[model samples]
Target: MPRNVTTAVAGVVITVCAVAAGAGAAVPGKLGTRDGYEDAGGPVWYWPVWFPIFAVALAATGVFLATRPAVHRPAAAVAAVLAAQIAGRAVVGVRDWFNADGAGVVDMSQHELATVVTVAAGIALAGTVAACFAVALLWREPARGWAALRPRSLRLLVAGAVVAVGVPGVIALAGSDAIMLAGTVALTAALPWGGGLAAAAWLGPRARKVTVRTVLACAATTVLTFPVTMLYLMVSHGYDVTSLFS
Candidate 1:
């Protein structure tokens, strides 16, 4: 099969599996309920908020792969990660179901099940972000307009710093807890793409084209904000990163 076709198929498969996993986790059942969930008490990061962001990312990845077939290698890597995450969850769920007690009751607690689901979701998120970085690197190419831009390193670094500082500032200024939470989720979802852009810019030729350079600069800024935002949440808001899966 052609590489482009393979990439598109893989993307579609990953997106479907990701959506299924998210939907399954969202269901209200013994596996989904928070009651007695091991990581339930960690933080306020809800599945409703996280799952949608995850699904969107997966969908976007699929679209990118299908539209930009040149990115097949990186896209395939990402799809593999997502598939592994789904497979891991399935394996755990099956094991729990089959290893029931003497009376045939499932031995896994609600918390344990929830934890497994959360962990799987977390893996997907992380894998997607990493894949974005890889794709950006693969897409890196020089543009003619980038030649006039002086001190590219300094400019990129400065742009990254601004993003790191600006996101939290904007959220704080929003002055509503709900808005802040929403902003954080949005930023988290966007971080990987931003980081990928940044990587491309940093790695691309100095005299690259104007549009490509601009995108790379923007991407760098966006990627840099994620860690800063997380830090702000941890120090100022007492947000626990580990609770993301919980």
Candidate 2:
């Protein structure tokens, strides 16, 4: 099969799966519930159908890991890490579900929260994939190019990812909780791309190796953010008042 055709198929699959997962997360017939609530409990983070949404996200993540880079070498390790992250997320997600009694009433506003998290996850995932494609599609020498990123560059990228994803969120929450949700979506989408660029800069190479180390690293970067964001949601108030649009 032609590489472009293969990549196109993979991209389409990623999009469809992501959309399905995200759509699964949305609660139906709840338009009026979109408003922000102060003192909303953490249970809102784990909606009733949370598993399906996460399952779709996991499936899409796997599909991408499988199809990315289009190299001859096996991607077993990358696949493994992707699986691990999803498994970890599932464990945490289920734990949250159980802790909330699984039958507990979902906050009317949870649909809003789910929307925020799902969008953010999608963005981070998509951006990292785009970065991988940028390396794979443009530079045949991904190994050499990715492997050459300096420490300073990697540090800068890490910092940039934090700021780009964080500052907007902080500002958004301060203005309106509704905008805080939007901030989550924006952060989830952009930060991993920045991280992927850094991964491409350092782990990325200009040539083939036993593995596309940079792509794997970039995927890991994307997946790792889930837990980090969850922790943030856990610690910080669910509502942000400083968001601009709120």
Candidate 3:
């Protein structure tokens, strides 16, 4: 099979896995309880929201890879966005850790905490891998890519920043916790990826070529792994499948 075709196939597989994982994680537990399954500190709908977004991004990346000869720009942009999302998630995790109140601590056992920590570490590692891939991909032709992307990257970054901050702020002002939570989660997950892609778009436009195909494959794997892992954790902790719309 052609390399791009292979990449596209892989992307499809990853998207399917991500969607499955999200569906699995969305399974609800006993009434008024999550069966000790914490949402990484978010609302019940978090996984339902998270997985679909991830799948869409993965699918888009795959399509771009399959159709485009030199997908360096778009791929790098996607990588950047993923990196930013990872960073944002990390920040939120740390902030939540510090801000956790006494009741929160009481609710989570040592094992649960350990599980959360392990999942977080896994996510962090995946993010790091994705970021590295993005950097390497961009550096393959730093001067050329950078030159082509520099002006556009700046504009994209600025626009992404504004949307990232502004949309959530507006949602918060609306005063619905559910809407605010959903908006915050969506933006936090999406904006960073946008910004990162834009920022990295202009980098390494004239660097030496590396095993881009392999790098892209690995990156896709890493991206898909996260949701799978999360699904496993949720199921292991006794979460049951529930309707996403309900």
Estimate TM-scores for all models. Answer: 0.38, 0.32, 0.45
TM-score preference between candidates 2 and 3, better one: 3
After best superposition, candidate 1 residue 66: deviation in angstroms? Answer: 3.0
Stretches off by above 4 angstroms in model 3 are 1-48, 59-72, 94-106, 140-154, 157-194, 197-246
lDDT of 1 at 156: 49
lDDT of 1 by residue, 1-246 (tens): 475676666565555556665665454323222344443222322232333444455556566766776645555434433333233333333333333322333233556555555554554454444344334434434565677344345554454444545555566676676564444433442233233233334443532233234444334544565576456435422346677678
Quickly count the clashes in candidate 2: 30
* Per-residue accuracy of model 3 over 112-162 as CA lDDT, tens digit each: 444444444444444445545454444434455545545534654565465
The lowest-lDDT stretch of 10 consecutive residues in candidate 3 is: 206-215
TM-score of 2: 0.32
| Model 1 Cα shift for residue 214 (angstroms) | 13
Candidate that would win on TM-score: 3
Better of 1 and 3 by TM-score: 3
Candidate 2: residue 49 lDDT (0-100): 29
Q: Lowest summed lDDT over 10 consecutive residues: which window, candidate 1? A: 40-49
